[model samples]
Target: MRRLFCLIVLYLLIGGAPVVAADWSLAAYWAKNSPDRMIDILRGLNPEMRSSYLNAMALNYRFHQGRRIHWEVEAQLVRHHGMQDHWESNAVLVARWMDFPWDRWLDTRFAFGQGFSYAWEVPPLEPRSDPEDGESAQLLNYLLMELEFAPPAPDSQWSGMIRLHHRSGVFGTFSGVEGGSNFIGLGVRYRF
Candidate 1:
């Protein structure tokens, strides 16, 4: 708990160095659980589907808007069901890339976020993915990678997204737990 607080304070200290045109957004997504690790999933390995699913909604505050890069903080409320039933929440700081060469053809964006995730209860399926580590925590490190696109119009407010939702212990940083869970999610976003 102390470590998490310290990290958040440090991140806020750095982020507070600048304030720009702030904006807000709302997003929602539905994700299915995968039996593969985040690395393998990103490497194009086929996902082994599980019955677990999560529906999530997020509110994003973009605090900085640079020409090529933007910074945002996001809060998510997620509901989990299927193989298990519970609730999870996440707070993340995201970095978004705004300028793509082919924007005139099809507008595209990529964003990466890192932060913390807290579950209503320790997830049972998490330890099964890493039997050797056999430890799961209610609170863990969270991360996401999202790619979204819209029409060629620069003023478009709606876009579709495919995101990778991941949670991990970061080599025992949380509770001497080495592994966690991953979800392949599809969603949409509306920026206002």
Candidate 2:
């Protein structure tokens, strides 16, 4: 899986179609201890959930253009804190809407993606059983809303963003279990 992800990124960097611009970012996030239904959150239904201390690192690339819609590819690695902990790898392609006008210093975007994920073991969940039903084959879906702060100067290469990362199985695509995960993240992006 790691080899496949590396190859995909290498291709993107060296052989992908030309784009007006591209941005790369690296981020770390903490998963919520109790999972929430994505629909509920999107519908303005907020729930109280605790932090799980599960840490994750995400690497992303955004293919930029002048249009409102753009594309992004992301790869993530997740790890837990205990000795019994395991790692999970997720890769996804996102379609994004980048039209929101927040301010002169910020750019706002919303996106959703579908892809596949693999875990050494089924992620332990609270208040719900394994959505994959102990099977490793899982469909991954994500919703991301991000705020990118503009660079300090016109030609600067550095910027920052805060993002909400929501991951789920989309109501049991594998079986009949409605389960998923969420994280709030901060990242630094470099544009070239």
Candidate 3:
């Protein structure tokens, strides 16, 4: 009888298993004001590289339709006139929240989490008594909203999305209006 019960349990587990493949998505984004503030801070150091101010980024993510957790990363490459160049990158941990009512034909999600980042600011052509440029690793926070084409489901029946995110100042060191940098972007998600 014990052997029969063990066999039954194994059968149930095998029968309920579904084979699924991991999927990925890529998004192109353009935004203003973000990292703009950082540029604002950097400009004070060297006013020459003002026009070279450009902000563009790509977002990448992997998802498991069976689980609601996802990971994301963003990089901002900005050029300045001095030896001190800067790259801001963050690795984010995101969780999709329950759907809520929006307008017609759309669903909403709230994803909030934090990440670890590396930041480097180059020094001026000529060093001052105090060089404001340095490298640091810090903590970051993100609060985002995703608006998708279809209703929320375990497998997302059919959906595309626009994700908006804001990050906090590297851990608790710098203070800004609540929420980190702000991003509003669009993309699609397909699940098998």
Candidate 4:
């Protein structure tokens, strides 16, 4: 099943026309179970070290364009706490507000994705049997808000980003699981 998903993503990235750009990034993050609600989680600024840590690598392919919106597909591999952990693949839609006064210094974008994740083992911090209180391995969702710093030159191929990474089940979407996980990550993005 994983092989099939990878093949599909490869096909979409290579065979599809109109895809003009792609980016790859590597990030390290710390994740923990938050007692706070989703909105509260979003409001907090500090990283919590209550659980474990992971490293992630992601490939993003931009395939579509609209007047104010763009679309991309992202495939990510996450190594939880230095162990082979999980794989998450998603189709993401992004919107950037280019008119921000800070554009000369950085770019701001908001992205949302819905996808599936496969875990080598049940997530260490999330409870398994009680779906109403935790998460599931079969399906998941992602949310991100990123600030991409401008490079030294206009044509520079590399940039840095501070991102808020979030994964959740969306309140019983996956067998009644509601809560999930959050990570604050810093990474560099290389455009190809």
Best of the candidates, TM-score: 1
lDDT (Cα, tens digit) per residue for candidate 4, span 1-192:
999999876654344345455443333333434434557657776534444555667677666643334566667776666322554443344443223455566654445555555555656554534544755554566666666665445676666766666666777676666766666667777766
Query: What lDDT is reached at residue 10 by model 3?
Result: 56
TM-score of 3: 0.42
Relative to the true structure, how large is the alpha-carbon lDDT of every model? Answer: 0.88, 0.59, 0.41, 0.56
Q: List, residue by residue over 1-192, the lDDT tens digit for candidate 1.
A: 999999876564344445545588999999999978888899875778899999999999988765567789999999999987999999999998877899998899999999999999998778854468868899999999999989988679999999999988987888988888889999999988
Residue 120, model 1: lDDT of: 93
CA RMSD of all predictions: 6.8, 9.2, 11.5, 9.4
TM-score of each: 0.87, 0.66, 0.42, 0.68
Model 1, CA-based lDDT: 0.88
Positional deviation of residue 124's Cα in model 4 after best superposition, in angstroms = 2.1
In Å, residue 136's CA in model 1 sits off its true spot by 0.5
Q: How much lDDT does candidate 4 score? A: 0.56
Model 4, 128: alpha-carbon shift in Å? 9.9
Ranking by lDDT: 1, 2, 4, 3
TM-score of 1: 0.87
On TM-score, the stronger of 1 and 2 is 1
Q: Model 3 over residues 1-192: C-alpha lDDT tens digits?
A: 999999876554333323245444443333323333333433464222222221334354534221223333333332222233445554665544533555244555445445544334421221222334222223344444555466644555456665554445443354322223433445555433
